[model samples]
Target chain A: MQADYVNPIFKAANDVFNSMLQLEVSRGDLETNDNLVSTKEANISIGVTGDLNGSILFSFPEDMVLDIVEGMSGMEMKEIDTFVTSAMGELANIICGNALTTLNENNYNCDIVPPQVLIGKGQTVAMSTEQVLTINLETDIGEFDLNISIS
Target chain B: MIWKERYKIGVEEVDRQHKELFNRLNDFLQVVRSEEDMEKKAAEIEKTLNFMGEYVVVHFDSEEEIQREYNYPDYEEHRQTHERFKQEIMEFKQEFEADKCNEELVMEFSGKLLTWLIHHVAGADQKIGEYVDNN
Candidate 1:
């Protein structure tokens, strides 16, 4: 996808992490994804419609998933259970919603469907054949990747 | 979960309702997560669920009223999100009333509620504050 479509997602991720999770995110390397499988333990996939027609995949490591749930709930989260996975999915949902809002400002006018949370590494997710751009993001808790395959 | 000062959207009534929503949800979560027997917690859980489902509607109405008052640019989009969440709450309430509510469903509901509130307040709701300030 063009930077015009991709940058909003990155910015929204950083903003949500900062404001909601009380953490700073440092952007890491960017690469292209040839495989449609997630390497991280928790994969949150959200569909986009309207101006964008593909899906957004947010893959988070197990530790980061636990960290995020614990941070938000103020309770100790030891494992990636339903509670943890659901929270992670909602996080992805919020990020995508905000990104679409930004895209609307640019006249892209997109909307996101409810997020689907997939647990376990190497999970295959449905995505478009369009070029998939993966951007690595680092936080004090852990690292994750944002995969954008929207056309 | 505790409501942080940062979650405020600069609108007094809306922020108050948000804090109340957090407090109520935190209580409901505590009941859901308690070590007590499931049968014993059933009545309390149902009561809280009813309160939450109704309170959310009232709060959304008030928030939407404010948005209309300020001519919030994203009023329709924002209201649509609220409608979706209200429908979710209704589904959960129906499940609970239908005797299908279990630990898994309760856990899932709590998790979604927690994350949804935080993000909506800190992200979407903040836009309302910004719009009012700018105008």
Candidate 2:
């Protein structure tokens, strides 16, 4: 994928974290993975269509997900249940929608569909793209992975 | 679900509506999360849901009018997102009508609404204020 596609997503995540969650996001080393897998407690996949066609997978560890949810809603959540997963899905949805808006400004004409959320530790997700660029994001509360796969 | 000061978008009317949304949603969520049985709370939940459904439409319309008055460049896009959420609310109403207003649906709806409203107000709606500030 082009840096044009990837940069906006990272910027969106950083901006959303800063403004909404009051958390600062730092980028970790970039990595590439062949298949999309969920190694965390909360995982979300949002599909990109229009000019860009693929999906973005976000994986958040259990502790981090709880903290993030707490920060967003001020609710004390203990488990990765329906409410938690839905919140995660909306979080990813906002990040992807914000990124696509940036792309639209550059005339990329891209759009993101609603997110599909999964909770668990081990599951392989089917994606439309072959080479996935995984961006590890660190927040004070915890860490999560943003896997970008677009053609 | 507390509404933080950071969620305000600087526009008085819009911010007021957003805060009202936050307040109502917080109350609705509180009732939903209570220890009361689902059947006992169904009437209250349905009433709050209906009120929220109507309030959201009014809020969106008012906000959109402000966007137009400011000639906000992203008015179309912002309106599109509003339409999407309105559709979701409509679906929720349908589910209620279909008598599927169970704990699962209520939980999912409340969760999605909490995050969606915050992000929309703080992120997308902020851009409109930023646009006005810069221009």
Candidate 3:
């Protein structure tokens, strides 16, 4: 993620969580996530369009995904499955949509494709094994990571 | 969720339709998410989707008339959003009618409907209020 992408996406997360979920979240410094794999992470990838054509990957730990689903839906997301994955993907989509709106006002006309849940622990994003940008978003129950690459 | 007074723009006709829209969508969501029998749920779910298809066009037409009355600066983009969503919902309902047993698509449509309503109200429609205030 570039600084622009990182900051705006983080700002979007903050605004959305605060307004929609009424949850205050904090983020740590941007770190590298070269070894991150979706097979091990409960993440959703949403594609972007217009000025930005890429995929924003939100990598969450299984426990954190459950925590988020529980927090958002007021129900128990006992395990990571289609229901849980779809819910989380919708969250990511909301965040991305909010971010796109902000970016649009900043002269970045962007839209997003629907969100897709990457299941299992073997599929990879096939990015260069470099120090990709990531932020550890700490919430009350758990934390999540936001990873992005513009293709 | 029901449309609140704060959601109104002081426009009689448009505001009334928006309220009806929120009520219909909220009712649809309630029934769709009900913890009820799957066999018995199909009728009500199908009904809501069919209603949404019609209500959206009527609601958008009424709101757009108000938008034109006020010369809404963002009318084009706003109408575009409505158009795209209407098309998507139509597609979703068409798919549901084709395969009534596809639980996955129904759930996906439900989730999208929930999120879309909240954002459209809290974010997009809120701007109409801003326009109303300024003009």
How many times do residue backbones clash in model 3?
2
DockQ of the candidate models in sequence? 0.62, 0.64, 0.23
Evaluated at residue B17, the lDDT of candidate 1 is 95
Backbone clash pairs for candidate 3 read: A39-A120, A39-A121
> Which tens-of-lDDT digit does each residue in A1-151 have in candidate 3?
2666667889998877765555788986666666445634687887787876766778778987777555544455567865567767777898998888788887888889888788666556645335456677877766777776663
Q: Per-residue alpha-carbon lDDT of model 2 for A21-103, expressed as tens digits? A: 87899999788888888768789989899989988889899998888777777778888877888888888888888898899
Question: In model 1, what are the clashing residue pairs, if there are any?
Answer: none
Best by DockQ: 2
Poorest 10 consecutive residues by lDDT, candidate 3 chain B: B1-10
Candidate 3 TM-score restricted to chain A: 0.83
lDDT of each: 0.85, 0.84, 0.73
Q: Candidate 1's interface RMSD, please?
A: 1.3
Ranking by DockQ: 2, 1, 3
Q: Across residues B35-131, which tens digit of lDDT does each residue of candidate 2 receive?
A: 7988888888888878877889999999999889889989998999999999998988788667744888888888888888888887788898788
User: Backbone clashes per model, in order?
Assistant: 0, 0, 2
Candidate 1, B9-52: lDDT as tens digits: 88889889998888888778778777788788888888887887
Chain B TM-score of predicted candidate 2 relative to the true chain B: 0.94
